[model samples]
Target: MPALVYLLVLMVIPLGLVIAYAFLTSGRFGGVQGPATLDNITRLFQPLYLEVLASSVVNAGLATFIAFLIGFPAALAITRLSLSWQTVALIAVVMPFWTNFLIRTYAWILLLNREGILSDGLALIGLGPIEVLYTREAVILGLTYAYIPLMVLPIYASLQRLDSMLLEAACNLGAGPWRRFRTILLPLTMPGIITGCLFVFIPSLGNFVIPELLGGGNSQMIGNLIRDQFLKSRDWPFGSALSLLVLALLVIIVMLQASAARRSRKWGA
Candidate 1:
């Protein structure tokens, strides 16, 4: 009951305020002032904002794809290790959490900046210094790096729970590694993959710092747009509307993930 009350006070109440602000009129100065209206929500449909929303989705999708490509194998490898090594591997995966997120982002800036280690190393190798910082690629890299642990942990937990006998039996039946994984390992771990994708994709979609610092403030995702509206432009109503839209997107994604998990369980059963 205490926890519930705390959630209501911290999360629910704030969310209710944001929703109310979304409907209320913007003050001549900044915040809520006049009667409720749909104007703020309507403004989101304008071409400029629509494009920002689309790009945010695309960038997040690309980041999730990259994370999956890297994280799945890493998680699998960790599961294959000895118990102590497994602990170490997981610690490594989650070590970034020990650091401040902003500091980690700034570290990426030091690496990707023109005068940073990457460019200097490239120049030493006789390749010309390439444009990497302030690009979509940098933002994607940052997003992937920041969220890879989110991808790995869920999948690792799933893989760890898998029955070893299934693989051994498949091997005894003349199944190759690829066949065993494809037919047995992959099917069982579908829930984890779905969960990890949800974990990575939702946060990636709303990330602002990666785009702002790594993408040089040009690559504005939905979070960045919302921040600009509320603080920079002082368009509180519009910002509140965007926040609600993101919340709605999160709810929809969670529903889709839940559906996928149910289907996976049905198929596994």
Candidate 2:
């Protein structure tokens, strides 16, 4: 009863309000003004908003790919370690969470900024400083750094459960390292990969902080755009619509992920 009441008060009510707000008109001064209309939803398909959505998808996709590339090997390395060492390795991968998220992002800014560590290192190597800050790549890099652990943990969980005898059997059959990984390891660990991708991709798509701090105004994503609608533009109706759109998207992605996980388990069985 308490749990149901909590859900009703916290989740249902707020979602109902947002849904109501999405249909209402925004006042000239701010807040809701008139009767509900579909204008806000219609405007979502406008070219400008569409572009932002597309770019957000692309940036998130790239971040997920990069995280996977970096994380899969890290997870494998952890799996190879002794049991005690495995715990340490896993802790190291998630150690960044011990610090504040904003602080960690600021650390990336210090490294990527002109006259910062990266630039200084380049100069020492006789290479000129590269402009990276306030760019799409910078945002992607920050996101990848922030979420790589999400990728690693899931894949590690999957890989850790794998039987060693399977690998030994594959080897005895003359399967090379690549063949063992491709035919055996890859298929078995796919659930973790999919879960990791969903974890990284969804958050990356909705994240404004990395883009705001690193992307600057030019590379604003959907989250930033929605923020602008509510704060800067004073367009509450549009903002609500955008929020609902994102909520709908998240629901769809979660469903798809759940379905994928079920399929993976079936394949594993």
Candidate 3:
């Protein structure tokens, strides 16, 4: 009961207010004032905003894919370690979280900027001054870096829970490594993969800071658009509408994850 009340006070009330604001008219003074309307919703479908949404999805998707490519192998490697070493490896994976996020982001800026370490290294190789910072690629790289640990942890948990005997059985039955993995391991880990993808993709889609600093505003995303609407443009209604769109997307992703998890459980049974 206490937790329910807390959720109502913190999450439900705030979400309700945002939803209400999305349908209302923005006042000249920067708050909702007039009668409710669909102007904000209609505005979101404009080509300019739609393009932002599409780009955000694509960038986030790319980041999720890349993180999966890196994280799956990393997690698998960690699982192959002894228990003591596995703990150490997991610590290393999450060590970055101990530092301030903004500081870590600034470190990337130092490495990716024109006069940064990357350029300095390139100069020695006769390929100096690569323009990496403030581009779409940089943004994707930042997103992948920021969220790879999230991908790793879930997959690690899934892998840890997986039965080694199953793989041994497959091996005894004459299945090769790739075949064992494809036919047994991969299917069993689908829940974790879905969860990790959700963790990476959702945050990437709504991330504004990485794109703002890394992409130098060249890769504007839905989060940035919503922020500008509320803070810069004082268009709270439109911002709320955009927020709702993101919220809806997150809900769908979560629902899909839940559905996949259920199917996975049934398969395991």
| Best candidate, TM-score | 3
Off by over 4 Å in 1: 267-269
Best by lDDT: 3
**How well is each residue in 1-269 modelled by candidate 3, as lDDT tens digits?**
99999999999999999999999999897989879899999988899989999999999999999999999999999999999999999999999999988888889999999999998899889998798999999999999999999999999999999999999999999999999989988889888988999999999999999999999968899999999998899989999999999999889889988988888888654
lDDT of 2: 0.91
Q: Candidate 3: lDDT of 220?
A: 99
Q: Is candidate 2 or candidate 3 better by lDDT?
A: 3
Which residue pairs show backbone clashes in model 3?
none
Q: Cα-based RMSD of the predictions, in order?
A: 1.6, 1.5, 1.2
Task: List model 1 lDDT by residue over 63-153, tens digit each.
Answer: 9989988999999999999999999999999999999999999998899888999999999998848778999999999999999999999
lDDT per residue as tens, model 2, 159-260 = 988898899999999999999999989988888998999889999998989999998876999999888888889999999998888888879988988998
Assess candidate 2 and give its TM-score to the true structure.
0.95
lDDT of 2 at 39: 94
Find the number of clashing residue pairs for candidate 3: 0
